[model samples]
Target: MTDMPPLILWFRRDLRLADNPMLAEAAQTGCPLLPVFVLDPETESLGAAARWRLGEALVAFSQALAAKGLRLHLARGAAGEVLERLARATGASGLWWGRLYDAPAVARDSAVKARLRGLGIEAKSFPGHLLHEPFGIQTSGGGGYRVFTPFWNAIRARDPGPARPGPARLRGWDGDPGAGERLADWRLGQAMRRGAAVVARHALIGETAARDRLHDFLHGPVADYPARRDRLDRRACSGLSEPLAWGEIGPREIWHAARSVMEGAQDPGVDSGSDSGAAAFLRQLGWRDFAWHLLYHFPQMGARNWRAEWDAFPWRGDSAEAEAWRRGRTGEPVVDAAMRELYATGRMHNRARMIVASYLTKHLLTDWRLGLDWFADCLTDWDPAANALNWQWVAGSGPDAAPFFRIFNPQSQAQKFDPEGRYRDHWLKGVGADDFYAAAPLRWRLDPAAPPPVPLIGLAEGRARALAAWNAGKA
Candidate 1:
């Protein structure tokens, strides 16, 4: 090995080793590597379920590193300070990490880069977090695209290049890397309380698990994904969202894998519809990218309405109805089932998500932010951009949003998606219902035998009220 100083490889959401741009580049340097994970203010601000899931990711990642004869050093503090101190302590010459696009992360990373460069450290950010850089794709006017269809069209054919493989070998720093915090001391899951155990039963942790999930998806469910994805009672989805959220898997890897199936490189049985299913799955990935793109262009998406005119709309805040919605006692079978699914498993079906968001923002007339915050706290698969974008899409407050007047009738939706009521019955009266009760906090006093709640408002009345408010805002 060369006598060069160690290079500090900071880990963020990009936790996996395979197809990781930063790790691949660092391995090519032939210099000693110091892999570190800092629990800075930005990370500390994560919601309860997300935070708890993050801790599990870190554990699995650390174990993966150990198998590769490397260690993941843990630290807690402001990122710039902690990184600078670590660099000085380890005699490191450079710092590298994958990029994040949320407003807070963007602001913090910019400051960190500036501070590190001031000290003569080679600070760099890579593009593994997303298939493409958020700012890289643009419209003819050199501005970000406000609409998603055009954004998807722009990127659909353009190649993102091949996903890189993990380094064959890693050279670790030999000297004292300096003082580090224990992962247990952080207590990342403390906020999750009683629900952690329930959610854990559903999570597929680490990179290996993520890769296996992708393989399994491409080989089976993907064939029928296009037709059955919205069927709430069927296991027709990829189930990769939680892994994708924590960077246990990279988007490019998923993209290329799906593309391979689309190109017929892998036989997905005799299903001729597999091609269409793969295409549909790829579009969902594109939607994830689109969310980040919108967030990059409009940082206020999470907190404010994307359409300024939406400010005039009357959105009720915390009340009994909103609380009932949170507790999954809305009396709308589909809506309650969806909410309870979130409580028990820390994830909601995509169709269920849209229904519940529409019910809250349009039917219950509650602010979309309320639902957004609840999802943030409860969803293991929670992504900042996706969460904000989807909520706004349902609320008709964001770019390319569904019209506000298109309120979903929960009973009608239940009939269409959960036609057999298997999904509703599962969460409301079956095993899922038991999990929800076990997971619920004691203070909520949720009884397993309690009857379903009454409707917060009549569907027609709520729709009319929402339409009246929408019309008034237009006027």
Candidate 2:
């Protein structure tokens, strides 16, 4: 048995050990495992904030592996070439990894698998990133769903099964695998510049931290999620987006935990009122799945308009107004506060996200792709599928999108969601403002005491302009 070649485990977005199907199956083989992570071209192309966050996830995952008496070998280059070199060097006979659905990953993985198998090396991909396979659920016509409600109905009752527990012990491959790059040398956070330090203050890294967060949310705040999830002043929403984005926590674990609360199986302290909230929270998760489904079925979704007719609509490109919006100087209190929050914390409340996105697309009449690109660069919790889908949805450019006439009045939105102005004042004039200035690039020359800028366009004026354009485009 000692003479047997090792099996290579490639780590990508699925970084955790527990509830990880790939890791659990690999452990059952009782063979020495060579864990590796490759910084391939696809990964290198991630946005600055996402790249920096990946580095944090890698650090935490490395620590977790060390605790289990295993080592994660770091490599750089094209994934296929890197994996082949490591396999040849280590005499690895097989390789396994969790599957990813994004177009780039799918293409890369397919090519890698074909090339590796030509050498007679065993390669396998497992499903754990998403709750269900993207193509698994379909309409009666055997086609993918376009609307979310029917998609939600199709999957809401199906059980994803219990979460898998991590292996207690694992055998590591003996001897050095190959020459590897040090994580520090990679400088994944180089693009982040000064913003890294500020965002770190709000980040909850590592698998353990993610699990603890899930527990805390389910035990208390989840009960109010139904009513307060959109309230900017309340902490009623789960802060699991970052964890979920990095695969620090699997969705099935969250699903089961929430189910336990809903069924009164795990926590008796949760009142019956929580049932509605738990159910509502589950629907949000379904939305996450639906986003991926749309992405899988429509690979160009992130780059092109899902509805081809949208191409005819006139969308303004980059300009002074757009720059002001990005810098949180648009003079709209709620909008500025949200943008500032994104700069300071690498995250903005869900309601804030919609408001800012609406203000940019409908009020400023700017292209949605610009806002999407900015978010890709700024958000630590960025998911390619979700970001693109949500942007298109708000812009009324995608399937089942909101109507173009449905513009968000930021002032009215502030009154409804942030009535006391606590959310706005905190991010605009309080500690959040201080953090924003600290994180802002030195070149921006932002002043903490500066009064908010005057509104770029009047609400009614912008609304009329947008409607006229929309009507013209339709005609």
Candidate 3:
């Protein structure tokens, strides 16, 4: 309506058009809108497997946009510079986007905001990625809660504003913007090769698929999430982690849908609000918030432990044992299966994460940071907050942590969770009894008679050593 050209909506983590505060704001501008997605070489240069999933998500998003006669413009380079160029090219008055909370993202956004302001272009951000902003929820003492329980308590006490509904309509700039690289030009799927091809054969990949998955879980697994989530063999887990990670589905929409159903008490048979299933599922969402809070408060948390003293603990780096665990070849069946699951599917179940993390840090006596790095590279859902916090939790070096002596017995974990051996069989041994276990990657292999490839360093020894280190400021 104004004499100036349209506003630029820079898409980052919030990839979908639904319930997005930023996109909603952009639509309100009523000016021509240039929806752009920048592939910052610094950030978008993720590992091969991550790229594969990203490409799929992008393709899905592109299709969604195309259906409405809109397109997501892709550009690659430093964010601030790329955005500045985009603004100039589009003759835009302002740039809009949702917030990102990571340290690197924060720094980048700050610079971009300053640059835009200098050019008299408004750079605005709204909340969409997280339910509660980092500073939104606070304790009685007027500070953020350090531990998760208190954090969650504060979160529940406060009302999250009603989620904005999905965008019902869209408008566009008259002139088409210049194109960036083709999706296939990025070659994100190169690393996984045959695995990527195979997974795509059966995987649903996009925003619509993500919504369907959410509905399916609500009707099925989520009803029993609390009781069966810890069981590795049960299909009770929602498997929505990756889609959530990819921003194919917004958390607010999920929250609203679940809460509405619970409030209605629509199905008396459903676990809904009354049982552990709904509560447990809600807790995972709480965890996502808690991790973001930690990252926001302690920016170094992404790279360092929450408890600083754990920094100096001795770690046997690149040892045969460590490599074995990395390669999914640890003689321990459960741990091996978990690593393979990660390698094959770009995700591992919640219980499996703890099992494998504990086996590496406590049993193998390796440093937790190394394991964290591996997960950072491997997990499709590798949120820095969740990955770092969960790793530190298992390593006994986090704010709320298990004691050093409480080691997980992988065998007991397998026996309890995979009682039917289905999980172990699926990845390690295969579909049937006749399917033999494949040879693990050459890095870490321990034959049954071999003495751990390194000494056992009994749990007691490891605990004593770890505790002493903790007391001595090196936990």
Off by over 4 Å in 2: 265-275
Q: By descending lDDT, how would the candidates be arranged?
A: 1, 2, 3
TM-score of each candidate structure, all chains considered together: 0.97, 0.97, 0.90
For model 1, the superposed segments whose C-alpha errors exceed 4 Å read 1-3, 265-275
The Cα error of candidate 2 at residue 461, in Å, is 0.8
Relative to the unseen true structure, what is the Cα RMSD of model 2? 2.2
lDDT of 3 at 365: 70
Per-residue error for 181 in candidate 3, Å, reads 2.2
Clash count (model 2, backbone only):
0
Per-candidate Cα lDDT values, in order, are 0.90, 0.90, 0.74
The per-candidate count of clashes, in order, stands at 0, 0, 1
lDDT tens per residue, model 1, 1-475? 4377889998999889998999998999888888999999889989999999999999999998888778899999999999999888777899999999999998989998999999999999988888888899999889888888788888887787678877889987777777779999999999989899998998889999999999999999988898899999999999999999999999999998888887784544212323377888988898999999999999999999999888878999988999999999988999999999999899999999999999999888899999999999999999999999999999999999999989999999999888999999999999999999989989999877777787888999989999988888888
lDDT of 3 at 227: 81
On the 0 to 100 scale, the lDDT of residue 50 in model 2 is: 93
Error of 2 at 198 (Å): 0.7
